[model samples]
Target: MYRYLEQRLAVRIMEFLRQRYPETALPAVVIEQPPKVALGDFAIPLFPFAKPLRSAPLKIAESIRSEIGSIEGIAEFRVAPPGYLNVRIDRAWLALAQALARDHVPKEEATSGKILVEHTSINPNKAAHIGHLRNAVLGDTFVRLLRYAGREVDVQNYIDNTGVQVADVVVGFTHLVKKSRPEIDVLAREPRFDYYCWDLYARVSQWYAQDKQNLQARSETLHAIEAGNNETAAVAETIASAVLRRHLETMERLDIEYDFLPRESEILHLHFWDAAFTKLKSAGVLTYENDGKNKGCWVMRRAGTGKSEGQQAEQALVQESGGERVLEEEDQKVIVRSNGTVGYVGKDIAYHMWKFGLLGQDFGYRKFYRYPNQHECWISAIEGEKHHPHFGGVAEVYNVIDARQSEAQSTVIEALRELGHNEAADHYTHFSYEMVALTPRCAAELGYALSEEDKTRPYVEVSGRKGFGVKADDLIDQLIVSAKSEVDSRHPELGDEERRSIARQIAVGALRYFMLKYTKQSVIAFDFKDALSFEGETGPYAQYAVVRANGIFNKAALDADEFARNVANKIPAEEFSQFLNGEATDEIWELWLSSSKTSYVVNQCIATTEPAYLAKHAFQLAQLFNAFYHRHPILSEPNEKRKQFLLATVAVVRRELTRTLAVMGITVPPVM
Candidate 1:
């Protein structure tokens, strides 16, 4: 509702300006919320128009105030000193509109094509850790935000099944553990297979450090896995498939789902790189390095550093120096090594080209995993089902990777642009975020031994290769145990299973919210106490606010929908105005205003590619409702109209809070 009013007013102001200043050019009008509610609901600065109109800002403000006729949902406009237009909305009308409105799903805008969001691409070698959790949760929440905004989104989780990580795990099982294929198969069927591999992976890392000769095994295993159809490749497939299943189960605990899981193995066996290499050569994006440190390799200029004139000048200088000049290797990124192996960036470029339908190749899809909700997840296969849903050819793509991969992501986009797919390159997004580390207190609580230096530091980075991080399953289990203990103590009357279910909900909420509360660029130091707290900017705090609001409706013996209907039927706009106006009812009015901005907040989140703003929105709305609950006596009011108005306020807040939490992948338990 707030966004609607802003757009309406902006259009009205623009139309008025065009008619008044026929010869002048105008800029886009932006609307902002006032600092205080008493000032007004929305503020529009007139300073930008002064230079274009060749007049003082105060005069422009006066002209707008006089010429801009009455707008819908707006009560009046006031011009402040110097140059500001303050808009006061009709409170009664807004309250009535909100009470009568259904859910706050924003209207879908027309889009050119489907959006592809690739997230949670954890390597299929070991158990997922807290660092992986941040990637998955951020990606999942962004998918939710895009879907909620009425965009067609395809969720993908890339599986690096044939990568060096998988090769290392295979080496661990065969060389260090000395286990045969059949022996490992039996163990893979056992519980916590991924956890077993996690420890083995760390041991392999240690073994490599003890003797440089041991590194040769990793290289041999990688080549074997890439070749396929051999015992080593089969073993690699077994371990990666098992670990990938465990990953899916862990993410499902937090309500994250994917539409497709494309594997690196298929990309290799299907010759995706062969096709991409052809295109790169035909487009002249790849150049052969005949000399220098990168001799006998296929290289390309780094993204944003491609300057033909400067390259020609450097080459001329080198020739003038009697062909003895050495080319700077740092300015070039190697796409394919001299040993005839394509680099990670080369494979990624092929995958992204497929994503935009420029590769002229498609993955064969087969049903691989099914969620409890009956959603089917497909995987890339050599021979897939004859009839399957299409997976590629998207109009836009978003890769939710860590900040460390920014350069690789940029190279892929640069390749796209060089290949003349500038539109796809322009639409590509690297939704990068910082890593997650454990706070010193959190590490100690998790029973990790810390050095004195580590203890003094603010955060401890998790190293998967060293097996020194919190596993995703273990963290979820620990959270549930802690939450269940609290639930058991607080609600002794409830059955064991009911308490357990509520605890799971709370635990998942805590985990997802903790992952999302920080901005993408901000590194998070995970701590149990901060995440599970019931007060102050935590998921539990927001969930509790919803539970408490529901309690009000329960105590009044009224269904929220029926209460809204009664308010809309019994109360008039004038009565709402009388009830919501002045200093005495400022808090109630503020709550209504906050409830109306859920769609606005969602739009802001999508535009900025940041979910932290929505997290902050939910927390702030929760804070306002909690304060209002303590200050206002809703059910016991003497005046019937005022009581109905207050109940209507509760209904609106309850609905919006629940919706907001749902979008963040958090569920409100029946009781907290």
Candidate 2:
């Protein structure tokens, strides 16, 4: 919100400089937080102009500091070591922050355009694992944060309902178990159907190992499913749809909800891919290579321009001629196989084109799942619901998947470029994070006792086929049980039902925060012991700091409103020592510094597509608040007014911390 004030000051400075120097253009100015509370609240690094300012940077800084006094909301200004301008805000100005925050009842606005975040697109045949949690949590956080920043977001969980995984599951049931829909539905009504399928899917993989001919059954099943007209296809759909519901229920437990469910089967059935293929061909991007690779299929001349073939080719050319330079060639990605069918890259390119409204077509939608006739989920196809609201027309799109898909993602970008939809391509973003692996303790707890060879690697890999990782529900169950016991211990007055609710909050918070705390690229080798901590860079600790802060506010008989009135309260520059006290107030000052840096974290996250920045800030905010909590005797302070101001500050910080965690997809426990 203060960005407006910063903008105004910058304009005035630029105008003032322009009047004085007619020949020189006004330079870029940065408005930033000062290093210390004693310093000016905002600072500008003039060293960027050490050459322009002419005199040494410090003298120039002092001159600028003197000139800067013309601005209001500024008290005294000083130059820090190595020539940084330290501008202290008038304490009275900070008091206005409370009012500004009050007047600003931030409405969570819809995103500027539709944001269809495709995440948790897990294979239908396997059980949901901890690796899936990372994708869903990060993707969901993006939806939350973007909405908070006033963006309309639509959360979508892509289901590979007709992929190889589901086909394998179909083979397992129809061929292996010889079970029909009613039998499978009965099995689904039982507990852990996903877990059962998880084992069955792995066993089915092994079943193929017994005989090479058995693979034909899988291939035929896949063809029949894709063709969408046979009993086998019907069975595959039933299994795939059921598994998807199971996955959604798992996500719902963690407070994740979605607007739509996009099935790959629908994408194929709707002829959206055919429409996309038509455009690509008309645009001369996709070629019908009837002769190339000795094929009957269509293909894309790899986007690479042949120079990327490698230096050996270039060296060979040089040896033949010795006088010219050859550039690296780029490789072509295949669109259609030589067998006259689409490849993974081809379907993905088509899906991406459709995502950005670049493809001249639309999917029909029907009422998705209706929960007790109140909650409705949407399904898309060629002739589904004809009057549903627009789904595509996204100003921005984020696909949250693993880093392994970077090359595949690039192909989508290339498709957009080839179609001349450069703006849409620019808006397309890949939110890639390293995979979540198992720490030794977590692995051992999950019944994956590692060999010495496994220990040699930095982290244990999570393999779906191996079925050797923590299931999301299993992890949540453990955390809830652990947390419920703590709740009962701390609050002996509470009933079992109330304690269960509290435990759910704590458990979900801990899991979501742990997943989000690192930058997306940082591989989380999650340790059970570390994940279970209630203090120090943990979710419960964040809640603990807030509760402690709230306790101080309550003791002073203050609430969010009353405390907000003092955000701009004046600091007595003369009584700096009394305020600092080399105690908790000092800790408060450090927390203040970190809390103020939240805007920077947010800006970086927006630019880099990294959710970990928010996670790291949440941890830092909690750590600082905890230190402040231990050092200050809040209600017992001698100066009532200063204590009131301190309590007010705590209220604001606590509100902010709780809000930050929510954006990270971690709900704060009500009584932590």
Candidate 3:
């Protein structure tokens, strides 16, 4: 509401500058809302352009204020002690704009092209734990915010079907259980497929440790599966495809949806890497070395880095498995290894190249899943070469990988830059976040005995190899149970089916918000007791606040439409701004002023990849609504015009809060 007030004031200032210092070139005008509401609604600091003005900043501010004289909707104006122009907006304009914003927002700013957000691309080997929740919640929220800002967005979840984690589950089926493909398929249909594989995969990891020679079986299975020509690959595919399907169902339970499910196997078969290799070779971007530690390898040098960089990267690989990293030549990466095979990073680079349309090749897409709305859920592929919707033209690509993979992501960026597509490289953001850990008590609750080393650790690390983590299905069941108690306490008359639906809504709200409440940099300790709580500083509170607002409006006996019309037709015709004068304010005005800061909040969250910023904003809005609700009455107020204004104000709060929570994938239940 005050944005125009600032704009008008800035124009006046520039005009003053033109008249006072005619020879000076005008600079860009930047107006900012002050840190506190009482400090005036907006401020302009002139020190930044003072040198060019050839006058003191304080004098310039005063001169501009005096020369510009009075402007519309500016209640008051003054120059601060430090030479900032402070301007307060007319309180009634805020109330009017807040009411108008809902019905009269510019159409161009309300809808725009979709953004492709790929997040929570977790391996389909185990349960979706808190770490996975953080990625999905943030990604889902990002999609909502973009859509709210009028941008089109397509969500994606990338499945790494041929990765080591999936391979371990395959090993568990073949070597440990000695189960055939049909038996494995039956086992996979159980509700606990991800859970079952979680334990089995961990056991397989331990089995390999017992005897070094046992590792050969895993290597054999991996090779056979990659070769795509044997029974081992068939069995692996059955288990992988089955378990991955289960993963999708779990995500659906969390209300997460996707536009595409791109599989790594499809990328390999599509030979995206083959095209990428040809381009690199033709461009002389990759070279081969025969007289080094990695002899006979088609290689590229380690991409150039600052002197202090790549040290932790070099140390981490050495510390883990003593596996060596061989530079391709100088500032390049090996597309294929010496013994004849592609590196994991090589396939990923190819995928990135293809995403940017740099590969000059595309995947054959096929409709895989039938959505409830009958929309096609597309999957990228090679075998099922059917025509589906377009798979790639992404305006932006986000890979929700761990920070540990920064080196590989950098290689992808370097490849794009070398290909002369700087925008593609620049647009690719490695949306990295820290891992989740199990609290000591939670780890103990899971029946794991701790060594002194474990006791001294900051948090119990989630080890895929050990299956030491919370399962997504397990958490969802618990959330539903937790939510039911609250629902039953509040509305005992609700039918069982109706209550269950409401409880699930509450469950999603509680879980998504909790996952996003903490700053992304803060490591989660996967505490069950803390996660289960619905009271204080949780999603339920935010939902409860909105629910209360809606209840007030519903019980007020006047529709938002009637209330707005009544206020306009029957209220005093002096134009409320004329009476708000120099010092008076309306609470509705404060709500409008505060409510308008959402775009900045959304951008900050996007730039920082931290949902906590949004979480804080949501909390603040909830607080504002609550305080406003206590002091103001709608239907009970005998003054008809005042009553109508309150109703309209509540309506604005309700809309913005809904949009804000939706941006974070937190659905506000109508009843709580």
Candidate 4:
């Protein structure tokens, strides 16, 4: 409703300006909310009109205020000194209209193309760590926000099943432990197989360091996995499939799910790279070098390059700079190596082209896993079901990879543009974020020894190869334990199952909010203490506000819907308007204004591609509700109309906060 009003007001302001200043060119009128409710419900600066109107902003504002007179739902307009039109809303009218709204409020639909969001592309080798959670949580929250805004979305999780990471784990089981394929399969069936691989992966890393010749086994394992049709390949597939299942389970605990899991193995077996290779060669995007360091390899001209120092020096000798100075082999990135094996980047380019449905190919689909909700998640296969949900051909793609892959991401975009798919390149988003590290205190709490230098620093980086990071499941379990202690201390009379359920809700809320509270570019130094706190700007704090509001309705023996239905016909117009417009009621009015701006905040979040704004808005809404709860005692108030109005305020806040939390992927417990 607030979103609708903002647009309506803008139209009136623009119409009035065009009529009043016929000869002058006008800019788009910008509507802004004032910092305080006392100032205004909305503010528009007159400075944009100053020079065009040939008048001071103050004079222009006053003139416009006089001309745009008596708009409905507007109480009054005041001209501030330096050129601002502050418009106060008709508080009584807005309050009554919103209160009497039906059970369901329709959202303004968003007009956008099908959006493909690829995130949580964890390697299928070991347990997911704290860093992977940041990526998954951020991507999942954004997906929720997009769906809430009425966009068609497809969620994908890319699995690097045939990558070097998986090969290393295979090396450990095959060469180091000297285990046969059947033995490795037995080990994989044991509980926490991913955890076992985590330790084994570290041992393999150390074994390679001990002697370079030990690395030969890794090369053999990788080649077998890539080539297929061998025991080494069979072992790799068994281990990768098991580890991928563990990764999915870890993410499901946080309520994250995906529509597709695209595997590199299928990408190789289904000839996706071959199709992409033909396109690249036909378009002259890949060059075959015959006599240089890259002899016999096919490479692409790397994006974001400048002349080398030696080339720049030679170019100065000629009047016209020599064209590219006989391009160095080092200047190109190898798409296919001298050994005829495709590189990782080459496979990624093919994957992205498939994402945009430009490769003229598609994967054979197979149902891979099922969520607790019984929704089937599909995986790519060479031979599979005859009928399934179509996976690709998206109009917009967001790859939620980390910032370190900026160069590789750019290369893929450049590949798209070089293929004459300019629109696809333009629509592609690299959605990059920085890494997550643990605070020094957190590292110590997890029993990781820290050097003095580490203690002095703000955060300690984790190394998966060294087996020195917190597993995603481990972190979640620890959070549940911490939250459970709090829940049990506070509600000992509750049954064990109920208490555990509430604790799990609080734990997930804390973890997801902690991941989202920071901007994407900001490096997160996660700390358990900060995340689980109920008194600060954490998930629990926002959720507590909703719980408090629910308690009020329960104690009064009346729900918000019942009170809203009864209020309109019982209270006199004068009495309701006085309660809303009186000077003493300004703080209460602020809560109403904040609750109504949910749509406004959603628009801002989508425009900026930032979820942090939504997080901050939710925290502010919660804060406002807490203040209102303390300042105005609804149940204890004697006046019937005043009590009803206060309860209505609680109802609005509760609804908005619940919606906000849902978008953030945070669940509120019934008795938190």
Best by TM-score: 1
lDDT of 3 at 357: 68
lDDT at position 607, candidate 3: 69
Cand. 1 Cα-lDDT: 0.89
Order by lDDT, highest first: 1, 4, 3, 2
Off by over 4 Å in 1: 102-108, 307-327, 444-456
lDDT of the candidates, in the order given: 0.89, 0.73, 0.74, 0.87
Residue pairs in collision within model 1: none
**TM-score of every candidate:** 0.95, 0.89, 0.89, 0.93
**Please, what are the lDDT tens digits per residue for candidate 3 over residues 1-672?**
444455577787677678877888878777887777777888888887788977888888888777777777676777997878888776665556555563333456554334578877878777666677777777777777666656777778888887777778888888998897788878878877777888898899999999998888888888887878688877777777677677667777777778888888887878888988888777766777766565677765565553355876775666577443442234446668877788877887788887766778887777767657676667776755555666666767777766667778887787777767788888888877777789888898988888888878879887777877777778988999889877888888888888888999889888888888877667888888888888877888788888888898678655644555455444343444543333444454567676765665776677676668888888878878888888776668887655655666677677677768888777877688
Off by over 4 Å in 4: 100-109, 306-331, 447-455, 561-576
lDDT of 1 by residue, 1-672 (tens): 877777888889889989999898899887888888888898888899989989888888788888888887888888887688888898988898888874434345655689999999998989999899999999999999988788899999999999889999999999999999999998887678999999999999999999999999999999999999999999999999999998998999999999999999888888999999999999999999887788899998787676589877987887688763345566689999998899999999999999999999888999999998899999999888999999999999999999999988999999999999999999999999999988999889878899999999999999899898889998899889989999999999999999999999999888888888999999888787776665577888899998998888888888986777677888888899998888877778999999998888888988889999889989989999999999888888999888888888988888888889999999999998
Prediction RMSDs, each to the true structure: 2.3, 4.1, 4.7, 2.9
lDDT measured at residue 666 in model 1 versus the true structure, 0 to 100: 96
Candidate 2: give its CA RMSD in angstroms: 4.1
Scored by lDDT, model 2 comes in at 0.73
Worst 10 residues of 1 by lDDT: 102-111
TM-score (C-alpha, index-matched) for candidate 1: 0.95
What lDDT score is found at residue 606 in candidate 1? Answer: 84
The TM-score between candidate 4 and the true structure equals 0.93
